[model samples]
Target: MIDNSLGEQYLRIYDELNFDNQASRRVGFCTLENYYATVMEHVGTEVLNTGIDIFGENLAEQWTVTKQILETVDREPPSEFEGILQEVKKHRGNLYHNFREDIPQRRLDAIRDVAEEWRAWLIDCAREYWDTFGAYTLEDFDYIANEINDYSQAYMGDIALKLPTIKRELDYAFRTIAKQRHRRLHYLETPDIFLYDLMPNKTSSEISKISTTYGKIGMMASKIKKGEEIDTDEGEDLMYDARNILISICEQEDPFGRTFNNLHSSE
Candidate 1:
């Protein structure tokens, strides 16, 4: 039997490794997952049917989707692989792991614009490669390549694979913080309403950070309460405040605890 201590360490190490892969793996018809699957499949065998099976195998192997794409392709490829890869690198963090920053919908739409084109182009290239060099005819390849753009196993699964877990966690935290902070800022009017969780070992510096963050949250609430015109900067400040407060929970800091030390712990 494996030692429990060693097992714990091993699991921790493994999780960290996957966590660091934040910049690497990606999902979707336009991501490295689909690109590598199409290229390597054509390299090894004729791509038939939706490219889902090949992408699935890549996932099973725990490959970093984008890195695998780079490794499989030459210094250059005919398709816009480089462009797709660049967009992935730029937004993958914000879209997937960046719970700290709420990405603008317009920005996500811009990235999706490129990704959709990449998906369509990738199928085009796959068909050409299969017809010219692979063991498949033009008609056979066309049928398969066409379905690559269809709703297949690989399509959404590829993109979902990169994000779901972190996205879910980040989303929950974001909503909870937004709601609670809003309550403190407007409904309760007192800091104590939503500041129950406290870190016993919180330092003065950390408390200062929380205070500043809390003030920002309150500012957002104030705007809402006043029925004033809240602009983009104010909206972003609310998001930042919510994210910071959620972060304190993870840091085990009793935010504001240091500043109000003399008050009763219950209070």
Candidate 2:
């Protein structure tokens, strides 16, 4: 628990954090989209950038732009700040891609862990800054505000630097998963069979599709190391389809018992 007065102060900081969080999420998604959009924009740009164009004509250009944008934000604490920023960016990417309907509770717990670290760091920074400057008046808040802004900007810049690489990896992973699903559907004895129980309001067919989709993604990932082409438009399309199935599954209850009941009824 946090002290009331401190919590109030923290609330102000929290608001700023929320603002930064939303901004970070937006930046990450924009970066990912830009990466793909750049690739599809023109053949020359695509070839020059090795199929990534979101940052600029190439990775170098993208890095430069990201630096400029991040320079407008604030600074962060010295210890492992970069790692925290990367984790945040990863979560942002996961959310953006709809890879998971809800971040695993464990991941959320990890986020809280980082948030605590950030809070402690910020408090220390504030205390040190105030001690050196001697908070002579209420006007001193402006200085602190500027410090916060600078820290946020710097932290975001660091994250921006890694965005391109992250995007590429995610795209590759998605495509690979898609290809595996495409191949797996052919080998299943009953590819359309339900693998779980649907909730009271859910349909068994939807559950089966979800199960099939999960298996497909697993299959695709296994084959990714075989020097397969997993970054093409076709691959992306397959991933998109698989993701749709997964999302549908998550939206409803499990279909295990319902599937069994139907199977027995058919017999």
Candidate 3:
């Protein structure tokens, strides 16, 4: 019943995402530009890596990488994904070259929604790819659970030195807050979680934690808006009330939790 935001869970075969698209550290509850960058950074990198793995290092560009992933997986992406990719490119162009300061909130939210859907599809395709080639996917003795094993294993020797740091990073990822599907399931299982509604001050610490988590998410957005890599924590919780609260907001508004993003907006 763990939330998907725990990035370590995906350490076995693929790296789809640790959290849902909107509340993830990648998007950081920020603006559309950050959301767009996050989608491209995660999805684009994965697709590009798949291409370089399957088709070798001559991968052309970001859009080409997405197409290559679709072809490699032998799964046709939905037609809407193509248009979404175009928007992704447009966002990237606007984010980088043109650098506009003015964009409509509705448009940004819409783009965030589109990017989330597109990334979800990409994750599905990646899962299919991993499932398909997982058996014969090793190169000699280079197999590692989640990492690509087709290449050389020269770095394996460093494992002795890096294991502690890796564990620390994972611990951080597990505690960071975000959107997750499992939040609803867990909430449904334990109605007592609603007791906090009856006695709000009883769980003041919990409320503070959620607020802090949300603040971290927003910080991530600001960092991404400035084109910084996602650097933050993934806070763990006993009941995952934080994630559920955000998901609830998304349900009332739209799929990508734009309500929370627009909470501070004048619009």
Q: What is the C-alpha local distance difference test score of each model? A: 0.38, 0.37, 0.38
Supply the TM-score for candidate 3. Answer: 0.33
- Per-residue alpha-carbon lDDT of model 2 for 58-112, expressed as tens digits? 3334433433333333434445644544555565556667743334444433444
Lowest lDDT 10-mer window, candidate 1?
253-262
Candidate 2 global TM-score: 0.23
- Model 2: number of backbone collisions: 19
* Candidate 1 deviant stretches above 4 angstroms: 1-81, 136-267
lDDT of 3 by residue, 1-267 (tens): 111221222222122333333334223223333433344345443323432332232212544665666687688767776665565455445544533333444444454455546556666665555334421122211212222221123233232233333333322322211111102223223334532332233466654554454444444444545666542223222113333433332223212222322533523
Quote the positional error of residue 105 for candidate 2 in Å: 3.2
**Model 2 score (lDDT):** 0.37
Candidate 1 vs. truth: CA RMSD? 26.6
- Root-mean-square deviation of each candidate, in angstroms? 26.6, 27.2, 22.3
Q: lDDT, candidate 1, residue 97?
A: 60
